[model samples]
Target: MGAARSRILLDNDTGIDDALALAYLAACEHVEIVAVTSSPGNVDAEAVAANNRALLALCGQPAVPVLIGARQPLRVALVTTPETHGPQGVGYATLPAPPGPGEESLDAIDFWIEAARAEPGELIALFTAPLTNFALALRREPRLPWLLGKVVIMGGAFYHQGNTTPTAEWNTHVDPHAAAEVFAAYSAAAEAGLDTEKLPILCSLDTTERFEMRPELLTDLAAAAHCTAPEIVSEADPSGTRSGASNPLVRYLSDALRFYFEFHRDYDQGYIAHVHDFFAAGIAAGTMEHRTRAATVAVETESPLLIGTTVADFRGLWGKAANAHVVSWNDPDAGFAELVDRLGALARQLDPMG
Candidate 1:
C-alpha cells in the first residue's frame, strides 16, 4: 500500500484514555490532526479543550486548533462520573491553569463546518467522546453530507456487553439523540456515495479491553509524566473500587472511570475496561484494518438503562435492509499489539528527555 496520511479532526471529551489517544495521534507520522473539538462526557467541554492542549504540548506540537463544543448532551444534562476517571479528568491531573485565551472561538458545529468545508471529502473525522457535537454539526450544516470523508467512531457495544449500562456504552449513553443521528448519518452517507455503503467500522470495547498496558507502555507513560504531573491511579482495579490516590490529573479521571468500570465489571466479570478511543485514532490514522460484514446496527432510543445500546444481529432487517458493515469480532491480541507498538513509537518521538 502507498503512504496516505489522512487529514483528521478529532472530537473528544478529554477523558484519561482520550488524552492518551491524543498523544498517540500527535506523534503519529502518518496522520495530520487538523482540529480538535471538545465535548461533555468524562469531563466538561472546556476542560476537554484544555486537556487537548496539554497532550499537544506533550508531543511538542505547537498550538493546534482546540475548539470548545457541547458542554452538555443535546437535550439532556451532563453526566460525569468522577469515581472512574477521578475528580478533574486526567485522573485528577491538576492542570497548571488553562491558557490566557482560548483559540479560534467557533462552537463545535461551526468549527466542524469550517474544517470540513475547507477539505471537502478529504477529512477523516474521529469521534472518541459522545456524538453530541457531531449530531449538532450535522444539523448546523446540512451540506455536511457533501463535505465528508470516512468516519471512524469509537463508541457503542455492538457484539460485546455494554460498559456504561446494562446494554449501553458511555459515549452513546451520554447522548442517545446524537448517537441516533450519527448512525442515521452513517447510513445516509453510505447511501449517498460519500463513503462505502457497508461501512460500519467499529472499534468496540472488545478490541480496546484486550490492550494490556505492557510494562514498557506504562513505564513510558509514567516517566513522561514525571515533570508534568504524577499519576494518582496505579493500575486497573480488579475489584471495581475507585482508587484513593493523589495525582494532579490521573486521580480525577481514574476515579470517574473506575466507578463506571467497576459497575460493568461487577455485572459481567469477564469485562475489562477498554481504552475505547485508541482504535478510532488507529483506524483514522491508517495503522489498522477492520473487516466489515453486512449488518443492521441500531441504537435503542427508549430503553430505561439500556437507552444508547447498539445491537448487531446476523439477520438483517427486512425493511431497513443490511446497508451497513458493522464489526462483529476483532483479532484482540493482534489489535492490542499494534496499539502498544504505535504508542511506544509515539513516546519515543515525544518524550523530551529521551
Candidate 2:
C-alpha cells in the first residue's frame, strides 16, 4: 500500500521541551510512535507520566500508551527542577486530565527489553531523559545493544559550558552513573563484534544551544496557527481580547515556552529559548542538517568536581576506539526553518478547521 512508517519508542522525562518534542512527533506522518516511557528528571516520574498523557490527549493522540519509568536515578538521590519547569512541569499550560492511568502491567525497563526483543533490528529507541531505565535494561539483558535498530540520545555538554554544573548537562548530571553505564555498555558491545552501525548517536548542547527559538519564529508559528485553526484561536478568547491562535498545538507550545523564555533571558542573557530535546528528536528522524564526528565518549562517574561530564576523546587520549557519533555542529538557519515548518505542518494536520 504505502511505505511503512518508522517505529519509535520515546523515553522522556516530560519536561517542557520534551512535551514539545512529543507533540512534534505525534504530528509527523512518517513516524509511528509505538509507546512512550517516562522517567524522573525535570520532574518526578509520576508527574512526568501525567504530563505525557495530558499532552498526548491535547494533541488528539490519547490512544498512545504512556508508561511510567524510574522514580529516581539508578544510584543517586532524586533531583528535580521545579524552578525551571514550574510546579507542574508544563508552566502555565493547563491540560485536561488523562483518560486513565498509564499502563501498570510492566515496568519501563522491562518494556524496553520486551520491545527490543520483539522488534529486534526495527525499533528506534529515542532517549531524551536520564539513562536509568536504559542502564537497568542493559544490566538485565546485555544483548540489548545489538538488538535495537538504533539509539539516539539527547544529553551531555560537549564543547559547550554545562547547564547544570560547570561540566555537566542536566540530563547526564541527574544520573551520571547510569549515563556512564550506558556509554560503556554500548562500547563493550561494539568491541565484542556487534555491528558498528547500531552505535548510539548523541545530540549534545554544543549543537542544540546554537539554534534558539527567537521571538520572530514564535510570532510566525502563531500566525501559522491562526491560519490553520481559527476556531482554536476563537475559543482561547471569545471576546478577541487576546492574540488569536487557533491551533491547540501551537498554543500549548507558546504557553509553555513563556517560562522557558524567561529562564533563558535571565540565565543566558538571551530572550529566546533552546529546544534541546526537539533537536534530538529531529536527529533521530533524520530531518536536521548536522555535522558529526566519531569519538570515544566516557561519562565521569567518580570525580565529584567533574561528575556527569562527557569526556569526548577526539584525540585518542584514552586508547579506546570510537563508540559514539557526536554531533559537533548543526546548521542553525536550516534547523530553525525545518523545525518551524514541521511544527506548522503538524498544527495544520491536527487542526484543519481554520
Candidate 3:
C-alpha cells in the first residue's frame, strides 16, 4: 500500500537536526506541510522562523507559510542553550537579517490556532521543540483538541538519559508548565470521545533516539551535489562539483553535524547523530510503527534536577494523561535503511540533474 497522506503543521526550534529533518519532510510526498511554526528553545523563536523560511526556500517549497511562536514560556523567563546550538541559533550556519517585521506580532500559538482550525480534525501537529507554543495554543483556543488528528512530539525522556538537564529533555524542560497543560488538554479531549485515540505523541527518549541518520544519506551531501552552505538551494544546483567547492548552507549543515558527530563519537565511540525530529516526521510520513497503548505519562516540573521528566507506565497512574503514540522501540538498521531510501529518492527528485 502507498504511504498515507496527512496534513501537517510543523512546530520546531530549528536546531541542527531540525534543519535536516525539515529538509527530509519537505522532500516527502505523503506529507503536505501546511504551515511551519517556530518556538523558543535551542534558539529564539524569531531566529528559528527566519531559518525555517530559508530552509523551506532551499527545499523548493518556499510557498509554505512560516509562523513565529512564543518567545518564552507562558509564565517563565526564556531559557536558551548555546552550548548545543550556536549563539546564532543554527550551528555553523550564518543566517541573513530578518526578512521583514518578523514573527513577534503573529506568535506561535496564534499560528497553530489558524492552521489547526483551518483543517479542523484533519491536521497532524508535529512538534519538535519546547511545548510552550503547544501549551499556549491550547490555552488560547481550548477547542483545538477537537480539530487535530494527532500530535507527534519529539521531546521528553522516559528511560534514557536527558540531553539538556539531568531529568528533563530540552523541549519539555524549557516549558514544563506548558507541557503539563498540553498533556492535560489532550487527555481531556480523548476522554470526551473526540476520536482522539488516533492522537499519538512520539517523545524524544523513547521514540526519537531509535532513529538515526545513516552514513548512506550523507553520500550526496558529502559530494556537495547541489547547493552548498550560505548559497541557498533555490539559487544553485547540487549535481556538479565546482572543484573543491560546496554549497554554503550544505557546508554549514555538514560542519555543524560533523562537530555534533564528533561530540557523540568521543563518548559513544563512532556514534552518529540520530534524527530526533525525523522520528516525528516519519510517523507523519506514515513509515514508523506505532500502536495505542494504555500508558500514562507525567511531567515533573518541581524537581530540582528532574524538571519536565516524562515517566511512562502501564499501571495508569498520574490521572492517565493523553500521549499520542510512542515508538517505544525500533530496529535501528531497518529504520535507517528505510529512512535512507526515502532520503535518496527525495535527493534525486530535488536535484536538477537526477
Worst 10 residues of 3 by lDDT: 232-241
- Residue 78 error, candidate 1, Å: 1.4
* Candidate 1 local distance difference test against the native: 0.66
True lDDT of residue 223, candidate 3: 46
Summarize candidate 2's per-residue lDDT along 1-354 as a digit string, tens digits. Answer: 122467889999888889888887776678788888988998898888889988888777888888875788988898998777878887656678876666744588888899899989999899999998899889999999888998999999888999999889999999999999999997898789877688898989998787687656767776665564332222123221233366777777867776676667667557677889888887777677777888889999888899999989888888887788898878778767776777788777778884
Q: Ranking under lDDT, best-scoring first? A: 2, 3, 1
For model 3 the local lDDT of residue 336 reads 57
- Predicted candidate 3, C-alpha RMSD: 5.4
State candidate 1's TM-score.
0.80
Instruction: State how far residue 241 of model 3 sits from its true place (Å).
Output: 18
The reply for model 3, stretches above 4 Å from the true place, is 94-105, 214-217, 220-252, 266-271, 317-323
lDDT tens digits, residues 1-354, model 1?
224878888999888678767866875778788888888888788778877776675566646788887778986778985756655676534445445565737776888888789888888888889989889898888567567676777877765677788677888889988988866776676556754532546666656555433323343333443424433333354553443322222333344444434544554643335566766777778776666666556788886767888876557544554435555455545555665455545554544343
Cα error of candidate 2 at position 193, Å: 1.3
Please identify model 2 stretches exceeding 4 Å from their true place.
1-4, 227-244
